[model samples]
Target: MTSPPPDAFANPQKLRRGLSRIWHATGYSLQGLRAGWGETAFRQEALAAIVLVPLAVYVGRDWVQIALLAGSVVLVMIVELLNTAIEAAIDRIGPERHELSGRAKDMGSAAVLLALLLAVGIWTAAIVQRFAA
Candidate 1:
């Protein structure tokens, strides 16, 4: 029987090339977000923060509070990106229906939900404090 191609397994050079491709893909993803004007729900939350940022500054809130609010917005985006990755990975593994794939996607969604809750909590506290004062 004939042997398969030697390049079937990745060598160091191939691994390096793969890593480079991954880097470029990450850059593309950023560009996509920018091009889309961050229209995703996660991006909308970021936009909301952008709008509130100036207001927060005008109100002269403490640095800690501002940091918390900004951090929460970032957290939502990060979690969403991770969720997208998880869903993509699952799909790549197998496009067919499977319990594990469903569970993985569901878990990723749950993580995003938790991040959203955190963002809401921060926004509510900051807005209430700014208005109350």
Candidate 2:
């Protein structure tokens, strides 16, 4: 028996189908987070944000500062979601101790750290300016 031609794998239609498959898989991620972390620290932090949002509105006094605060919160959540995706993908590849897998997870974690730092800086500046005024 002869193997299939390599060009078949490289076809543009096939690549498009693969991208669609990945897009559909994102629903699984949303479900996982809703059933897992959404019930724990994620829920608590989200609740805290909800509570603080009104107070921020009352005290924000400027549109730019409000946008900065909102954008910073969103950035943290976006980084966290991407980090979770990386960790999940690595585990799905293999539940074993491999150097590459560790590195991938660590790199994802580093991205989250940077996002957190950005959020801290934005919040600190906004709050200081708001209170000092």
Candidate 3:
């Protein structure tokens, strides 16, 4: 008989704790980012983040504003990563079309859209606050 599939939740990573776990986790996170870099949407957002984060300093009037501005940009990238992850997982399941798969992909896309809108609103407010009399 063929071997059964390994348990998903209880794997070797669970045994790690403290600094050792963090060190490995950080490496895994970087690897994920490298994978994310391959996606066009993620690459574009990263490029935008490169410009917007520095621009946040100029547009923000105070520390709070700067933090909000920078945080908003980061939020977009985070959401994009999550959306890409969702799409990747769905695609991995199979090439065949399924209702749930379409719904999940759509929801993931909607999440990215919402994040972008939020970032835009925050940046717009910050810009107006900095420039308006």
What TM-score would each prediction reach against the true structure? 0.67, 0.68, 0.90
RMSD, every candidate, angstroms: 6.5, 6.1, 5.1
State the lDDT of candidate 3 residue by residue for 36-132, as single tens digits: 9999999999999999999999999899999999999899899999999999999999999999999999999999999999999999988887888
Best by TM-score: 3
RMSD of 1: 6.5
Write model 1 residue lDDT over 9-105, tens digit each, in one string: 7543333347796897788788756744544765676687687666556543888887777777778877877787788689889879999899999
For all candidates, what are the clash counts? Answer: 0, 0, 0
TM-score of 1: 0.67
Task: Give the alpha carbon lDDT tens digit for every residue of 30-71 in model 2.
Answer: 787675465354565566567656656655668877777777
lDDT leader: 3
Worst 10 residues of 3 by lDDT: 1-10
C-alpha lDDT of residue 66 in model 3: 94
Candidate 1 residue pairs that clash: none
Q: Model 3 residue 17 lDDT?
A: 70
Off by over 4 Å in 1: 1-39, 52-60
